[model samples]
Structures are given as C-alpha cells and as structure tokens.
Target: MPIHSFLNYLALEKKYSQHTITAYLKDLNSFQEFCNNEFDKQRIIEANYAQIRSWIVALVNANISNRTINRKISSLKSFYKFLQKTKEIDSNPLAKHKALKVPKQVQVPFSEKEIRNAINLLDEEVDFESLRNRLIIELFYTTGMRRSELINLKLTNLDFANETVKVLGKRNKERYIPLLKPVQNSLKKYIEVRNEMNTNETYLFLTKKGKKIYNTLVYRVINNYFSSVSSKVKKSPHILRHSFATHLLNEGADLNSVKELLGHSSLASTQVYTHSSMGKLKEIYNQAHPRSKKN
Candidate 1:
C-alpha cells in the first residue's frame, strides 16, 4: 500500500491537521480491514474495481449513514488520487465513485426567552455543580462557542480586565469572544465556590474530584438544564449557539459580522441563522396581524 506516501503527503506536503489526518487514516484502516476480509488482501493497492465496489457496498451493509459514508468516500478519493499522483497506481478508481446521498438540514432551535429561562433555572440551584452549570450555560449562550472549544477552555484564556475569552476553534484557529457582564458575574461566583472545592485542576469547569470536564459531561449538564426549563424546545449545547446567532440576527446585526464571531468558514453557513430569525419574525407577525388566526 502507498498509504505511507499518501499519509506523508497529507502531513508534510498538504499540511492537513492531525485531527483530519486521523480521520483519513481511520477511513483507510476500515477499508483495509474490509479488503482483507473480502478478498484475503491486506494491501489495497492490489484491489480491483470490484473490490472497491464491495467496500462501498459493505459500508451500506453496515448501516452507516449516507453522510458518514460520503465522507469516507471523499477520504478514499483523496487517498487514491495520492496513489495515482505518486505513480503507485495506474488509474484513480475513486474518480468515478459516487458519494452516498445525504438528506437536507432540518435543525430546530430555542427561542430567546426560553434560553433566558433555561439559564435562570440553573441560577436558582444552590451548589458548586449548580453554579458551574449556570456559568456553563451563560458562557454557551453568551459566547456561542462549540462544545469542543468550551471543553478545551482553560482558566488562563479568560481575561478579567479585557472581558474576553480566547477560544480555539476548528482547524486550530483562535478567536476572542466578548464575555457578557452577567456571565462574568456568574463566573466570578462560580470561581469563588470552585476555589472552596479546593480542587488542584487549572481548568475552569471540573468534576468534584478536580479533573477537567469532558465534552459529554458538558452536553449532559446543558441538556438536563434546558429540559428542566422548557418542554417545547430540544435542549443541547449547539442550540445555545444557534440561539445566540439567531438572537443576533434578529437584532439586525450584520451577517458578515456574525460569520466572523461564529468562526464560520463561509457566509452560506451563517445564512442558516437568518432562517432562524425569519421563523421568529413569522411568530411575531402571527401574534400581531389580524389575518393570523381563525378566531
């Protein structure tokens, strides 16, 4: 297999990030395993078109979602293209490959008042965990950071005087988001109680034992808090982010500015929040307009 050369190309020549490289390697490794099982072949360089087709069919057989399989197909296309460019293979098999179809997006987010109530519910509780939960909710709602960025946050990233926290976003890019005054006050209270816990961890959010918080723990905490506050909306960390973007859009913030704040790679990605705002506008229109209901 020319996997070595391709990996080197991705790492050094292409400069793909470690996370991306890992995903590519993982997909190739799965394909390698499939090749070994189906044709008693370990090296994929010897794989014929039929073998490649079998791998695609196998992914479908494994009940992988079309989106996931499509990503894997992309990895394969890149891998084989590397093989061909390096003169390891005669032809690029994945050039004609079809990706599995992915369904359209249908994300539903929370209303602004519902979000405030959710955070307020967390505020009513009286414990270190509760305080921390409140702080987490505030930070998510205020900053609109991704779950990974929130989990990766350290005490050092927060600047009390500057009123901002530097977040490391996707592709290892750095962005500073302004921390809201209310969120800052809650953080101060949380820190006071956190210090009382006497944990040795340097991370902002932590377990009772003093270890840094995991992504799942943060998700579950936010999920539980949101569920307690609102039965109508689906509560998740991403929803807080969605709520943030939607709220900003509703306030007549520039779309490009929101794109930069959210660290979106393109304006098209940020445009979805406009739809979120449009939905809110429709609700307002329905309540105020005489033609709204059958009454």
Candidate 2:
C-alpha cells in the first residue's frame, strides 16, 4: 500500500520515466517478499537495518552481483527516504548504510573506423526498415541519447528547420541536440517511407506493422549491426552512446559541452567518458611532445 503511494510520488511528482519506476517497484517488491518470507514482517515500511542487511546477505548468497545488490539497496534507500519525508516513518532505515563496493568497469568504445565501416555497410537503396535502422545508429552515435529517449521520440521532436532534436532525458528533462546534415538527409529519406505507411502513430520509428518500437528491437538493431563491425563482447545501444562521448572527447571537445550534449545532470557523470579517451590523449601526447617521442 505504502509502496503504491511511493510509486505514485515517483511517477507524478518526481516525473521518473516508466522504465525507472518499474525498476524501483521491482527492487522494493523483492525486498518486501524477502521480509515476509524470512522475517515474518508484513510491511517493508516497518523493516529495520538488520532485516535489510539480512536481505543483502540473501542476495549475496544467491550469487547476485554487488552492483545489482547495491541498486536494489538504492531503491530501498529512495523509498525509505520518501516515507520519512512524508511522515509515514519516524527514521530512515538505510540512513547510515554504505553502498557495496562495485568494481569499476572499463567500457571500450568502438573505434571511429569501426563505426564508419558499420555505416558503410548500410544499403544505398532506400527501404523503410533499412533507412530507419541506419537513422537509429546515426542518431545514437551523433546525439548520445539513451535508448529510451530515442524510443519515446515523437515526430514533433524533430526540428528540421533548426537542425535540432528535442530529447526528453531522465527525470523528464528536455534538451536539444543539433542534427548533422548527413543525419538530417537520412531522416528525410526515412520520413518519405514512413509517410507511405498511412498510420497515424506519432512515434518516429515503427515496426513493419506500424507499431511503436520496443527496447529489445532497438537493442537487436544495434547489436546485429555492430556485431559485424566490432568484436566487442558487448554490443548494445549504450555502446554507441559511449562511442559518441568518447569520440567527441577524443577530438578535443570540452567536458562541459559534452556534458550538456549528453544531457548529464552533473559533470561527474560525464567524466566517465574521459577514461575511454585516455588512449587518444596518450597517442597525441607521444606524437606532439618531443622528449616523449625521443624517449
């Protein structure tokens, strides 16, 4: 019951995307079920730190990764914080809790040559699906939008006149991304085919049946194409996004500008891309610095 109210708060007041709201609800429900089965507790709001710790132990025993367990804990933290703020709870259970140590992962982005090869593989002949998929890949690499943002894109969001796209980012924040001429040309070609479908769906990308696209389909599109170009174990839409930021930074783009382009709420979030750009920086330094080159 309290969880329902908290979810409503997340949806209505916090304006969290549905995907995020679902993750929060899922994490909370898992904890709730754990409390009921293990501790005979009927309500999560009544749970304390010890009970929460027991759930963490159970998750660890079940072989769940620390990163995943930490995310579940974060969901609980936000829920309990909301409960406290609304006077439903006297004190927060996770007030003094520390997040589990997660090993930092180095995400290797696709090289520019790899990305270019993948784009070149696209058929020159214009077909609806082909054009749409090409546009999808181009948009991800160029704009650095989250997959969800691309999926939820409406036709109205495309500002052809200004060569910009209005993306609705996390927490319903809006940011405009400038579209390159090639991407704009691709969009024009895709639109010509899209209009022939005669469906009134406002969403920009659609399936063969003119239905709005889903996450799996988008992931499949990116994975299928990138599989041919790169041998990376993980190929997904986010990789293209990572490539977008990495490549931009590799070309001397400033951190703050990349931060705004990526629609990051803070500079810290944008700093992760710098790690991927380090190799480029090292190469440049070695080439330009005479002492380093001599050594």
Candidate 3:
C-alpha cells in the first residue's frame, strides 16, 4: 500500500521513533476507517477536503476535542503532502486548510516539596525494584530526559568518570547531559543491586523478570509513587521532567542552557517550562527590583 511507503519514509528518512511512527499509522488508519464508514470510500488517499470536513464534524459530534481532531487532520495533511512529493497527487488537498483552534493546555509541574516527599517515600524501600524506581525518578528529574529516552537508555550511555549520560532524543539526535552527585549515587546503588539480578538486558531499566521495561510500567511507577504525596491530577514521568526544567529555571538557569538540557531543537519548545517559573520570577522581582524595595 502507498501508506507503507510513507511509513517507511518516516522511519528511514525522517528517523522517527517507533512509538511516533505507530501514532502516525494509528491516526491514518482512523481517518481511513472514517472515510470507509461515512463515504464508502475505501482509499483515504483520494479523499478531498470536503470529506475530511465531514469527518471533523462527526468527530466533534462524537465528543472528540478540537485538539484531537486537529491532530488527525495534521496526519492527513502530512499524508497528502507526501503524496504530492511522490507525484501521486498533483495538487495538495489540505494545502490551504486551516487547523481548528485549540485551547492552550498548561501542564503544572510538581512542586519541589512534592518531589522531595516522593523521593523520601522511594528511599524507604531497599529492594531492587524500589532502587530501580528511585533511580528512574532521579534520572527524569535531574536529566530532564523524556520517558522514551529513559526507557531506551543503554548501560553504555553512562560515563561515571565524566559524570555525564548520553541521551538519544527525538529524530535519533544524541546529547550528553551532566549527572548530579545524587543521581550518580543512585546509579551506583541501583547498578549494584541490578547486577545481582543476573539479567543480560542492555537497557538501563528492567522488570523483575529481567526483561526491558515498557512505557506503561514506567508511567505506573511514577503515578503510584507520586499519588501518595501529590494532590495534583497529573503525576507521571513527563511531570517529573516538567518539574526538572521548571525548578531549574526558577533557580536562575539560562533559557538556552535549559533548552539544550531538555534536548529541544528550538527555544520555543523549551519556553513552555518558563511559565511554571513565573511565581519564582515574581518573587525575585519583588525582592530585587528597586521600585519594590521602597517602603
């Protein structure tokens, strides 16, 4: 199928992660299914903007959010663009299409106190799983790496002597993150316990059965640990990463430095975490600003 060629282009040329490729495939398949059911059109490649508009209406009527509908349309737009590139379509159907407006989503990072409490809870247990979980949490908070990067982290990525970890970020880009003392200590302890497990897995994290850890399990570990301390609705690895970047900026880290640490190609992507540090900025302004110092 033509879609397979596009998927291969994404994988081989674009160098997208499997998780990302899978999401793209899912979105395309969803649109194909919609076209099949509504317009009896088996091939979504030939679908026009009018049919796509009907699908959007159906999605809205079915209670799907505008953000989700926009994402589906984005995938379709990319597909059509690919078709244009391959000479399958002369004119792009969604070349001039405008995306639906989506409300801004602000992700609240966990507070420093909450992070401390969560770590304290993890420190109570002495088992391999507990140590591994604590290390994962520390890695996220200290390194600011994504969950996917953490999961795919290899043992060879660690450079204890230099106190840096090599992280493979989006599009298979590699960046080295400096390791803090606490994180280094956690790694040492976790590795000691991990070695006793006798597993031959190359990945950094693993389950009790000595296999590599999955995405859901990493999320569950974060959620289950943080639920005891945080009252926030979202308590996952991404939140920990958010907390990491937010807290660093709050402590007066440079925006460009944070951007590099977070492996963001552009400052705009890293700028999202700056919002979480607004309270700290206000506090600093109140204390240091000459106007605020007057009685």
Highest lDDT scorer: 2
Model 1 TM-score is 0.65
TM-score of 3: 0.72
Q: Give per-residue lDDT, candidate 3, residue 199.
A: 81
Query: How many Å off is the CA of 234 in candidate 3?
Result: 1.7
lDDT of each: 0.84, 0.93, 0.92
Return the lDDT, model 2, position 277: 93
The sequence of per-residue lDDT tens digits that candidate 3 reaches over residues 30-80 is 989998888776698888889888888999999999988888888888888
| Residues 55-136 of candidate 1: C-alpha lDDT, one tens digit per residue | 8788889898889988887888898888888788889777777667788775667777777887778656778888988888
Cα deviation in Å at residue 16, candidate 3? Answer: 19
The positional error of residue 171 in candidate 1, measured at the CA in angstroms, is 3.0
lDDT of 2 by residue, 41-83 (tens): 6688999899899999999999999999999999999999999
- Ranking the candidates on lDDT from highest down gives 2, 3, 1
Residue pairs of candidate 3 with colliding backbone atoms: none
Candidate 1: 10-residue stretch with minimal lDDT:
225-234
Among all windows of ten consecutive residues in candidate 2, which has the lowest summed lDDT?
A: 117-126
